[model samples]
Target: MGGVVERTDLGRGDDPLIGRVLDGRYEVGQKIARGGMATVYQARDLRLDRTVAVKVMHSGLADDPEFVSRFEREARSAARLSHHNVVSVFDQGDDRGTLFLVMEYVPGLTLRDLIRKDAPMDPGKALELIEPVLAALAAAHGAGMIHRDVKPENVLLADDGRIKVADFGLARAVNAETQHTATGGVLIGTVSYLSPELVVDGKADARSDVYAVGVLLYEMLTGVKPHQADSPIQVAYKHVHEDVPAPSLREPALPAYVDALVARATARDRDLRPSDARVLLHQVRRVRQALDHGVVEDPELYADLMPGVRPIAEDTGEVTGELEREDRISILGADDVYDQDREVTTAMPPSGVATAVPPRPPQNLAHNQPPRVVPPPVVADEPRRFQQPKRSRRGLFLLIGVLVTALLVGISAWQLGRYTTTPSVISLSQSAAKAKITKAGLTFKLGKAEYSEKYTKGSVMDTDPAPGDKVSKGGTVTVILSLGPERHAVPTVRGKTLEEVQQLIADADLSLGEVTQAYSDLVDEGMVVTTDPKAGTLLKRDTAIDVVVSKGPKPIDITDWTGKSAKQAQKSLEKQGFKVTVDEQFDDTITKGKVISQTPNTGQGVKGDEITLVVSKGPELFAIPHVRGLRTNDARQKLEDAGFKVKVHHSSLFVGANYVVTVSPGEGTMVPKGTTVTINVV
Candidate 1:
C-alpha cells in the first residue's frame, strides 16, 4: 500500500512468501512494501514473461472464509473496469491458503513520494496530478463500484509519466465484513484519509472516496493533515467530531474557492459532500477554469463550492499527528465508543442495515452489575436519546425478544464459540504455525519430524486435524516439521567379500547394484576392491551403489621355445611385457645359437613375469695327440686313452713288430673331439 517495488526495501530471506511460486505461474520475489494491513512483493509472471506486483493478505484475514469470499467477489468487480488510469488486476488466487492478488507492475515512484518532494505545490500542478486519479474513480463510479480506499500511497506515478490508481475495492472488501476490531484495538485503512462516517460506522459509498480525495487535496495544498492527536484513536475521534480546516490557513495566497473545494469534500457530514467522484470532478474543473482565468475574487464559486448548510473549520489548521495506525472508529483504550462483538464497532441487523446507536453504558454502576461498553452517538433526528418507549409497547416487544433470545440460544448451543477450527498452516515455519494454533485456542503439539524434499528444514511438513477441521476448545494440534532430505554416507567396502560388501551397503542405507570383477594383484580372489560411487559419498536412501571385485592375479600362458631360435623367442616375450634371460650350452646335434629348452615353458604367468631361454653353442673342438716314431702298441694305447678310436697299419717299409711310422692323419690338428689317429709298422 505504501508503494511498488521500485523504491522498496531490499528483499529479506525470512519472509516465507519471498521465493514462493504461486499457482506454478508467478514467481514471487522480494518484499516491495509493508503497510499496516498487507505486504507487497515483486514477482515475475512466468507465463507472460513479465514482472508483476503481488499483494498478500495477512494470515488473520486470509484464513477467514467470509473475508476471503468478499475479497474475491470485489476483485472480480474491480477487474471489470479497465481504465488506463487504474492499475490492472491480472489475477487473484489462494496458493495453499495464502491468498494473494497479482496486479500490473508500474515501474516508478508513488504519489506519496511526490508529496514528500513537492507539497505546498502550485494548485494547478496539484490538480494536474489528481485529475487523472479522479477520472479513474469516475470510471469506477460509473460502473457502480466504489473505491473505499483512496490515498497517496495507492496512487502511482509511472516512469512514462502516467498516473494510476491501485488496490481498487480492496478497502471495501475489508470493510464490507462485519466491523471487527483487530488485535491490539488497532484500526484499519490509512487513518489520515478515513471519512467521518467510515470511522463512525464502518460504512462507505462513493461519497467516502470523495472525502479521502478532499483530504488528499487539503494535504497537497497545506502540506499537512487536517487533524492532529496523540494516537490513532484520537485522530479517529477528531474525524468524528472535528471539521477539516481550510488550506488557505496554511497558504494565504490561495483563492477561497480552493478552500471551499477541500472543505466541501471533507465535510463531517456525508450528505453535504458530492455524491460521487464524477460530481466532484465537474466541480474541480470549474475551480481550475476560474484559476486559469486568474479570477482572484470569486465569492460566487466559493458559495457554490461550500453551501451555507455545511460547517467548515476556521481553526489554526495545525497538523494533527502522533501515531496514526488504522483509519477507523476511534473508540479505543477507554470506552469512548463500543458495543458487543469486538469484531465490529457497529453491529448490523439481519437486514444488513446498521442499527441505531445503543445508549452509552452507565459508568460506576452497582457493584453487582457487569461491565458494558459505551456506544458511539447515533445519527438520529430525535434529540432525546435517553427517552424510553411506552410501557405497553415495551412489554409486548420484551416478551417477543425474550422468546427470540431463547430460541437463538437453544440453536447455537452446539457451537456458541465453544470450539475453534484448525487454521491452514501448511508450509509455514514451525514458530509461525504454532502461533496460529495457539491463537486459535488450540494446543501446539510437535509430532515427529520427517525428511521432506518439498519443504524447507524447520518448516511445517504436515499437520493433524488438518486445515479447516473443527477442534474442541483447547484441543492439541499436532504438527510435523521437515528435517530436510534423507542422506547417508556410503561405507568402505574394499577388500571385503561379496556377502560382506552387501551387508556394508545395506548398513549404510544403500542398495547394492551391479557387481563387476577385475584383476587385482594385491586383493584376494572374490574380494571387493572398491565401489563405483566410491566410499564416503553421501547418497540418498536406497540408491544403488555399484562395486568392483577382485578375481586375484590373472593367468598368462607361456609359449614353449625348445629347439627354436633363441633371439626370436627373446624378442617376442619382451614385447609382451615379460622380462627375458638366456643360457647357452654346447650340443652335438643342435644348430648353433638355437634354443635348447625353456624354463617353465608350459606354466602360466601374469604380465611382467620373467622367462628363461637355453640356447645351443655348437660342438666342442680338441687337438689330435702326436704319436709319430713311437711303438705301435704304445701309440695305440695312448690314442685310446685320449678318447679317440685307434687303428694300426704295417707299412711295406715297416721297422718290425712294435715299430712306429707317421700317423695317417696329421697330429696336432683341430678336429671333432671323438676323431681317431692311426700309426704304421714295418
Candidate 2:
C-alpha cells in the first residue's frame, strides 16, 4: 500500500490503464496487481489475438535512471527462465517515463482463495497440488534464482487444476549483483509464511522455502496454521523455541505420514531439512505417490502423532490361548482390521469359511471323560484351598526367577554395544579431529561462538565430550566458532599536520605506513593532510594505513634593470633565472655610456623574477633655416617649416621691407621633435 497506490497516468479517459501497446499491436488493460516497485495489468495482444499480463513500474521509479536500468536487466534475467512452472517474460520497454513488462496472463484462483475456504481437502489431493510447485521451485532454485516470497498468494491454481507459480517480482538471482531487492531494508519476506531464518537473521535459503511449504502443507491437512500468535513477531519466536506439533495431534483423523513429512520439512535446523529445492521436490513426489496409492501408513511415524498411545500389537507365534489366536488372525477380513471408531469382529471357522457351530450335549461329554468313577469325600473348603494356594505361589516364584535371568542377559548385551560409543571431542581444531571422526564414521556440527578472554582467538574453548564422555559412532560434535579480536575506532586524523597525524596514530597504538599526496584546493599549504583510510574507522590494533600531506605552490620574484643595454639586461637576469624587457631613449642629463636607475630598487627583495627597463642614448638638437621677404615674422614661419621652430625678426637694411636671413643651428640637423629657434632682422 505504501508503494504505487494510484493509476492516474495509466488509466484511460474513464477506465484506468497503466501500460502502453507494443509495436502498435498490444493494448494493455487496467492495473491488476500493485507491488512496491511495479504494477501488473491484463493486456490484449492484437497481433497474436491473445491476452497477456503487463507489469508496469510506478511512474516515480520509471523516471529514475538507475531503476529503469535495473528494471531492464531484471526483465532479461526473467526471460532466461524457461521452466514450465515459471511465468514467461515476453517483452519489456521504457516508453517516455514509463517502464513495463509483457508477461503470460494466467487465469485462475490463487492458492490463497482455496485455503481461505476452510474445508478439509483430501490429503492426497493437497500433495498433488504442491508437487508441481516444488518442481517449479526446484528448477528456479537450481538455476540460481531464489523466490524470496513463497506464499499462497503467489501460487495460481488454473481452471484445469494445474498449478503455476507467479510473481517472481521479489525473486532474486543468486551470484548476481541483483541479489538485494531494490528496497534496502531487512529483507524478511511476507510475515505469515516467513521462514525462521527470515525471522531471526533476515537471510533466506532453500531450507527457508522448505519451511514455508511445510507450513502450507500443515494448513492443508489440519485446516489451521501451526502458530497463531496475535502478531508475526510472536509467531516467529514460537517457531524458534517450540517444536512443531504433528498435524495428526491436532486433527486425529489425518494420516500420520503427512505429519512426518511436514515435521521434516519444517525442522528448525536448516541442515536437518532437505538440502535444496531438488531434494525437496523428490521428497514431495515420493510422498505424493505414497498418498495417491493408499500406501500412506508409516511404522515409525506414530511416535510424533500419538506419543503415549501404544500401537496395535503385531502378531507373534508365541500366543497360544483361544483369545490370542482370535486376535492374531483377526476374525474379520484384513479390510475390517481397523474400524473408524472401534475394532470390528467377523466369525471365521477353523476351515476359513464363515460357518456357525452348534452346541454339544452333556451326555456326549460324559462318555469318555475320566477313567475313575469314584467320588472323593468332601472336606471343609478353607483347609484344602489354603494348601492349594501355597502350591500356586511356588509356581509364580519360579516364573519370576526365569524372567529376571532373561532380562539380565538382554541388558548385558546392550551394555556391551554402548561401550563401543566414541567420545565427542570438539573445539579442537577442525583438521585435528576430522581424521579421527572420519575414521569412526562420525560427523560434526559447528556452533556459534562463545567469546573467551583466556584462550587465543581460535584456540579450543570447550567440547561436548567434556574430555571423557562417550558417544556412539556417527555422533555429531559441535565446535564453537571464534570471534577474533576486539578493536576500537581509529581516531580522526584529517586536517592535522603530517607530524601531528603520525603522533596521533602512535598514541592510538597504530603505525603509519605508506604516504600518498593528492591536490586539495581547500587545505592549506605544507600542512599535514587527510588519510586514505579516513578517520574514525574501526580497525584492529597495530593496523598500518597510508597518509597524505600538502605541498605549497612554487614561488616566483619580480626583478628590474633600468638603464642597462638590452643585451646586457638579458645576460644579467638570465644568470639569476629572471626574464627581462628593454626600450632605448634620449636623455637631457645622463650620457649614452652607463646604466641609470635600477628597479626592484637596490636592497629590495630580489627574487630574480621578470624585469622591465628604460635606457638613455644622446642629447636633443634642432636645425636653422634662411628666409628674406616682407613681414619678417611670416618669413620666420617659412624658415621653421624646414625642420626648426620659428624665430622671427624685423629687417633694418631695406626701407619699408622686413626680411629674415640664415639662422645658426643649420637646417637638416638631427633634432628632438619639439625644439625652438630665435630669428633677428639685420
- TM-score leader: 1
lDDT of prediction 1: 0.73
Each prediction's whole-model lDDT (CA)? 0.73, 0.56
Report RMSD (Å) for each prediction in the order shown: 22.6, 26.4
lDDT of 1 by residue, 210-308 (tens): 998998998888777777665445555566656687788789999989988887888877988999999999999999888889899898998898834
Poorest lDDT segment (10 consecutive residues) of candidate 2: 356-365
Candidate 2 overall lDDT versus native: 0.56
Query: Tens-digit lDDT track for model 2 on 1-682?
Result: 1122222234444534534565465687776655454566778866446687777665765664434434444555565566677766666665555566777777776676687675356778778778877887787778776666676666777777668876554334211222233222233244445665664455677788778787778877777767666433344445653445677776777666677677778776676677777887777776776666777576654343222322222332231111212331222111332221111111111211121111111211111122223356897666433444334587788899999999989998887676444444334565665566567666666666544322346644444433233456567666654454434456686577888888888787565657877644456665756764678876544445678776533344434455445567667676665555555567766667444555543443333455655566656654444454335667666656655566554445545445445443454555654466555555
TM-score of 1: 0.48
